[model samples]
Target: MPRQAKSAAAEVRSLREEIERHNYLYYVLDRPEIPDSEYDAKMRRLQKLEAAHPQLADPASPTQRVGAAPREGFGKVLHSVPMLSLDNAMSREETAEFEARIRRFLNHTGPIAYVAEHKLDGVAVELVYEKGLFVQGSTRGDGTTGEDVTANLRTIRSVPLRLRAARSRGLPERLEIRGEVILSKRGFAQVNAQQVERGEPEFMNPRNATGGSLRQLDSRVTASRPIEMFCHSSASLEGLHVSTHWEFLDLCRGLGLRTDRANRRCASLDEVFAYYEATEAKREELPHEIDGVVVKVDSLELQRRLGERDRSPRWAIAWKFKPRQAATRVLDIWPSVGRTGVITPIAALEPRNIGGVTVSNASLHNMDEVERKDIRIGDEVLVERAGDVIPYVLRSFPEKRTGKERKFHMPSACPRCGGRVRREPGEVYYRCLNVACPTKLEGGIKHFAGKHAMDIDGLGDKLVHQLVETGLVKDLAGLYHLELDALVDLERMGEKSARNLLARIERSKQTTLDRLLNGLSIRHVGEATAKALADHFGDIEKVLAAEPDDLLEIRDVGPEVARAIAEFFAEPRNRQQVRRLLDAGVRPAWQPRRGGKLAGKRFLFTGGLAAMSRHEAQARVERLGGAVATSVSKNVDFVVAGEEAGSKLKKARDLGIEMLSEQRFLDLVGDA
Candidate 1:
């Protein structure tokens, strides 16, 4: 190796060791030795060094944990040893019976030593290491075969990338350890809080959150989550020896695998039951969620004698606690319309706290679930909240249902808008087909101002909602007519912000025909169809004049596109809105393909420009019959790089693509 390469390798190894030590301290031991900022700086430096020296790249390096490019789908991994499931014991009698069965299998009358541990409410995964360096990881899918999730698992800090050396022995050549990947109660809450902030759906429970995180196609997403793991058993332990399960777990911990401190070694069934009782009593106080206690015969020899039965091991059983459930009355059941127009029944419960969270509402999924559960207003219902998610009604007490109890039926007319709702064939959901529904209109307004549509700046979902709810904006045309005072009065909209938004709205009036058409959100009309229509017609008037036959003549415009276009234009309400838009100074125009203005030119932009926003510049290029690209390449004719230009500018210059400043671009395009 070169001298520099040798130094880089040494530094990489040093950084990896430091990062793993910190990870063990923070995640496994709950004691952070270094400040988070300092840790972050080290991670960034490590990543930079790794990127600089590709030959020194190692999957076991801490820098590799942030994840990589998204995969299309997960590859299948067949487990060398089948990942078995555990049979459950719901009560003391059942647990005793399980113990009796194990004793019968072993043919031993003496007190059998057992290992008891928390049955974590988590997803099971198998982590494989070769020569004590992490190589592969997978989900426990169907035991025998699993989805490969090595990248996602590597993102978890508690999962060891490289095993720590034991003072007494050499590292294993190949080791496969099984563990439960979990999210703590606090972590689940934090994740859900982020979800609400992002306007995405909240996960139902910690297990649900963990599962979703693990299954993310983009491992970067998994890296962002608060996920941890606890290794409990081994599938393969080459070059390692232990007499009992308890000893194996200790060995795992010594090798930097996170092990549960809550585990207990019990010499008899009485001691196991005592541990279960204590664990169940202090369950809520535990950092992570556990539904039961897994009791396993400690002796590896005894376990072998009392070998596997079906998918479960005869030596181990999950002695589960009674499910956490509470009784609550259903105050009311109402139908709510969602973004996609599916009408779901939401039940309002008489406020009762379950699993440390106050329960107010539960989604009944559909009318089918409501009927199946026989859930009715004024009926007492048993509710179950798994890991502090919103409680679901387990079953309604039919005997307690009074004559005053009301059965909910899906409304014929939409609740949000008085349009007819109908259940379509093959779908259980009842949908309001009306586009004019307030809920649907809200979704449309968001799409209208989206980047691919009008490219309107500062007009987000929250602002649009405020405009609609305040009755200041009713339709698409209403946006153009928004007064400064009205916008300023809306939530979170200061005068300065409102003015910036108004300026963007004004600039959007000069958009190309394609963007304007796309902003309309006509059914079956997407970006490609809109562009085709714009290229064929060039102006709004010609597009409005073109019949279905004329539309069908265009390339890529099939019968469906033609029909949708015809229907959109034919509607009087839509036509009036288009007219109103034109009156409000919105002009939609484009150059025809045969014309020779700036045709065949491909422009890519980077950084801030003083003259105009990037979208406006792109629109101008398109109007003059030029094409716009987002990346730098030799094929691109012009790279319109401006102030603070980054890597793309250098790349464009290197590739010999013509570079133009804001002024040069304006001069070339005739300053339109």
Candidate 2:
């Protein structure tokens, strides 16, 4: 080998060791020595070196975290040992009963040491290693067999590809480490923001996001997400011995695997309860989502002696925190028409305080969800606030229900416009088919003049409602032909206000193609998707003429979204409305500027912009041929942070992505 090659190989080894030490400090010890930017710089240097000299790179290098190719699909892998579920203890009495039962089963009254660890709300998986090299990983499908997700697991940086050698003993010949894949609260928020930007359904919580990311057939997609793992237990192992559960966790940490540092070794059940109480008190502050604490027998001998049940182990019990639920009588079930015309069932409830918020209503999600939960009018139902924001009906108690409880049936006609409603094939939502429904029209017009859309200033919700209610504005085209005198006659509208509104509306007609597409209120086409469509097709006529397959060729346009766009354009009424709007001087011009200052860069803005509104900043970026992203990712070129910037700013700093203040951003865009 050349001298320079040898030098590069030595530096790579040194970098890997330093990086692993930092990972251990940050993940296992919960103590970081350096700033995230400094750490990221070291990582980038190692990655650049490894990329330049692949022959000198090691498989265990940190740069190889998300380097795997996409897999076709997950395969089935049988667990060597079964992964049993834990029995739950919902209350203090239940927990005491569980301890008494364990003592009775063991026929012993002696004090038993226990290990209490946070019960992470996430997807469980088993990672297998042979000769200290990571080999396979699988989900806990049915305890006996699981779907192999080795490629997806490899994408998580916290899961070391190679285990470190023990100081007193040789490397393990075989090991099966069990852990939970979690999306942190910050990561979940970031992912949901991306989902909303792409017009996809947002996941309910971090657990759902983790599960969905693990199940992706394409491993590359999983690689893009920030997933984490914490090894809690071992399914099987060889060439190692640990008499206690805490000792096993220590061993895991020594082996370059992440273990929760918050775990406590309790000498008695009282101590266990104390640990549980302490953990529950700090639950909301934890980065990852945890629902409860798991208490287990510390001694391996005692655990084996207690033995396992058919579904759960006798040695372990999960003491769950009380779910944030409140009993409320359903006053009524009403259908709400969304901008996309989907009718959602909402339950008006007697106001109850849940998770510190007084919630008066809960979403039934759809008719299917309502039916599954058997929710009825006047029925006493338990409502839970998912992620402490959206309230949902958990279940209804039929035995406690009064005779006045009324069964809710899907309305045959739309409630707002009395139009026909139909459920599409393979869909759970019932949609109003009438395009002219007043509810949908009102929603569409509101969205069209929204800050993120065409951004017509002075167009408030009241004005839109009055225009729709009085039949003054039948469609978007009607806005272009509105007379100033008629607007001045409306409630709260004067001559100056009417003239300013007219000027805003006229100025909105000269928007770009992306804004125009967004203003059209097409189903599943959000601001990001609209920008992608406009960038790809460049002309409105081209986009209209494109087939579903052609639309699918663009990034972020899935089959459902492509079909929605095609079906929307295929409607005769929609086509006529578009033609009328075009004839009314709604010209969406496409001007491609090459090599502009911000061209081809992706920018993300968070917090409040003091100098300008977020919509104005986005428009400026778009005018410079740049794109705006909703989440922080490796692909983002810069984050334009403003006042009170939150998680996105932290994430950008962690990834070593550039950041700009409002003034700096304006200078870059030549607006300063």
Using TM-score as the measure, which candidate wins? Answer: 2
What are the models' TM-scores? 0.60, 0.65
lDDT of 2 at 588: 87
Give the per-residue lDDT of model 2 (tens digit) for 227-328: 899999997879889889989898998888999888899999999989988988887788887889999999999998988987799999999988888999
Off by over 4 Å in 2: 1-77, 92-115, 132-135, 147-171, 182-229, 240-275, 282-289, 297-315, 400-404, 445-467, 470-520, 534-553, 556-563, 566-672
lDDT score for candidate 1 against the true structure: 0.84
State the weakest 10-residue window (summed lDDT) of model 2: 193-202
What's the TM for model 1?
A: 0.60
